[model samples]
Target: MNARLRRIVTSAMALSLAVPLAACGEEQTDAGAGEKTIGLLLPENKAARYENFDYRIISRRIATLCLECELDYRNAKSAVDTQKMQFEGLVKKGVKVIILDPVDAQAAKSWVNSAAKKGVKVIAYDRLAEGDVAAYVSYDNESVGRLQGQGIATALGSQASTANVVMMNGSPTDPNAPSFKKGAHGVLDRKVQKIVSENDIPDWSPAEAKKKMTEVINALGPEGFDAVYSANDGMAGGIAEALKSAGIRNVPLGGQDAELPALQRIIRGTQSFTIYKEVRPEAETAAEIAFRLLEGKSIKSLTSTTADSASKSGIPAKLFSAEIVTRKNLKDTVVQDGVVRVDLLCTKDLATACKSLDLN
Candidate 1:
């Protein structure tokens, strides 16, 4: 194996082993009496990770911690009003704690206040919801953006000095988007020749990203931009389709959320890299926090430190580090963790690519 590949594999393995070990070392307790209910509110269904990974892992962890703990699940489906209704319903159900990945971070402030009034404890999950909450759990988001930027810069190498880049960012309403954009700009501003265009994708919608990409393509033409900074894997696919429609190939795109299609693109050399924040550990951490809150156990010892939200500061939080997933670490990271099963990743069309990577 090449030195670069070997180094990546070792790093990935080390990081992979560290996650579960750290989680196992954390304090855990069994659920007791009164059949407490915990509400889980996810932002939207557009991102495959929410349903395929986040929900499953969180549900499994919650179940493991508390067999009889009632889970009230709801998907906002990208509607702020829908999420508001769901939040209200969860509060009405008198859930002990609500784990929310809000549809609109700013708008959700009112909802958080409402929940607080009703004596419901909220754990902001994945996406940090504004206003007072008991805890926050997510990957270090700004670092996610920095990794995306650094990946694009590294892919272009010396060409980065003169490379015109386009940034297709996530939902303006998402609290994380600003952090992602800020982190990316911190790197790209110093490296790139010029940012040809940058857009905030409302709702983090793939269709919106595609539409914005198409607009960018029309303005910049096929060869105008050297790379694209896609905020997440969902938007990365749309950006890829836009580039393909314009007959632009292999433009060194970067994404987060190591979704299957993004990894496939990395293998085929369409996308340069993606950030993999292991959702299992993130979910498990959130579950641990929720259980402790419900059981009236102190969480001061488990969390790294407190986080500052728009409405409030010093909110307790558990933040996980993210790994940049390139072709080099594909086997050692996602594949090794079974985030995406080999059978699923190695589809008929991706079979040859999978074998080339020794993923078969």
Candidate 2:
């Protein structure tokens, strides 16, 4: 790891030591009379990481940062209306500091403005929700797309210059989607023969991606596209299934989010690569920023840079780096970082593959 990444990992480790093991499951609302509340609103649960990793990590980090602060957590399940209602509810409950991952970035402008009117500080988490955001925490999303593009080019090898690529992008409502698309296009347009087909999926739905891939296959035949670029692992899973159903094999496929199943597919030689953005530091950083904001403390030390949204400029932001995970460095990247355990990743069925990679 580089110096900055090492510093982030070190900070996360130190914060993790603050909360005891026994306090992990304690009710967050069981605070004293004068205790404050921090609201956490996530965009969706369809992607397992939001509920499985992000929520748990942020909640735990908050507990570690402020034992007296209560967390009001809610998931929008990918519904804009639901998220709006949830945001309104949080404001009504007088939550002064809210960490919001909006379902629709554009729609969040009014919500953020409303919050600001009530003297509530809103921290944009993961997705850059437009408005008067106090602080934004996420990976360099355009860099993520560039990494995916580079992975595809590398996987294509000698055929990269002549390869036809199909692109399956994420939800349009997500503010980050356009940047990912732009970054990927920046590389792929110059590297590949041509982009044969492209589609922006709704809700980042895997089923929709599969259906679109199937349509592309029907229109262009098996040899039409040499490789596929998916914006995320969830949709990539759908694309993988679509390829399988069509009996298409050995096509270079790439995705982000380093999801477990995607990593397994990489081991099995189905998927080419995944971009692993360490969620721990991102979540922990958000928690720390939110806590500091709640306490009216300066967060100049926490944020590394500034980010501009559609409705806001020079917003305090901490953007982290990501790594592209391929079969060659599986052990070095995710394994060494303890993102996934060898025992769990190397299942009974994958014993030979595990042995071949010396993952055991």
Candidate 3:
């Protein structure tokens, strides 16, 4: 069983034994009691998700929830120090609540502590940081990994017994990466024949993933691995390109993030599948939590359950479910949600593929 399932079972058993603990009552400064500034610190801008979806949805929800509220947004560009500096600047500016998607989960602890000292609440977003935080909002990350692994296994089927698999994971700095890796391994290790190459992506950078894939290709040869377990769509793109450059074709590649390009690749049969975690709900939930904190309101009512990070226990969290997007449900999911337009998806080269697959 995955951590989520285990946790759910544990939570059920512990419910009767649960003792009422004092909630972290809002600590609104004099300035914060009125018009509030909420800091939105995102980890990077490279992934289209942050710029295209996360920021827009979260900002819009905050605007809808609180009219007088202002969002001070900053992208860290995948730099831990830069993120720390941006967070400190928000503190100096007296933002009441900060919703942070950390570049480095462990390193963000110091900033979380600093914000606490000033009576400011820090809500960990997307990726859980290692600290005593106000709240955390993200998808069930282990489920994402399981989906990716299952996709690859489904694609390969009986070949899974003989085929070598390459596991391409996300950045080591982000805490969620390990959960994803563990979850993928949970399924892959038992089903797959062998894992020939596995490596951690330095920054979850496509360029880095491409370079690493190229080296892996050279070392393992073109026909060595029959499947790839790409942690997310960005790295999947890199892996796909590397395979194409090496003249490898029809190799099953699994990814998360359900990026447009990866979805396009799935339709064209160049990639196998991608996991889609609807960002709208996650973003809105975090925004709502921040608004509540600023208004001196309790957030315990908003939480669905609790999660643990490396350094904290029983941290209040709201983790959403993830869906696997393949050729089977492309139209039903991302396309229907307007995450990708039909015209954009069926353009030029993909027109025939889209039509043949009844993607319209």
Query: What TM-score would every model get versus the actual structure?
Result: 0.89, 0.92, 0.90
Q: Candidate 3 regions off by >4 Å?
A: 1-35
Q: What digit string (tens of lDDT, one per residue) describes model 1 on residues 1-360?
A: 355664564354344332221111211233332238777889889878787667766776677688767666778898999889878766665666989999888898988988788677899998889877889998788888888889999999989999999999988889999999999999999999999999999877788899999999999898889999999988988999999898898789999988889998998888999998877678878988899899999988768888898789999888888989998889988887667778988889888888989997
Cα displacement (angstroms), candidate 1, residue 247, comes to: 1.3
Local error of candidate 1 at 259, Å? Answer: 0.8
Q: What is the C-alpha local distance difference test score of candidate 3?
A: 0.84
Whole-model Cα lDDT of every candidate shown, in order: 0.83, 0.88, 0.84
List the candidate 2 regions with Cα displacement exceeding 4 Å: 1-35
* Model 3 per-residue lDDT tens digits across residues 1-360: 344554453343234223222112333345543247888889998888887667766777777787767777788998899899888877876776899999999999988987798888899999998776999999889888888888899999989888899999999998999989988998899889999999999898888899999999999998888899999999999988999999999999989888889889999898999998877779879989999998999999778899998788898899999988889888777776656778888878888889987867
TM-score (C-alpha) between model 1 and the true structure: 0.89
| Per-candidate clash tally | 0, 0, 0
Top candidate on TM-score is 2
- Most lDDT-accurate candidate: 2
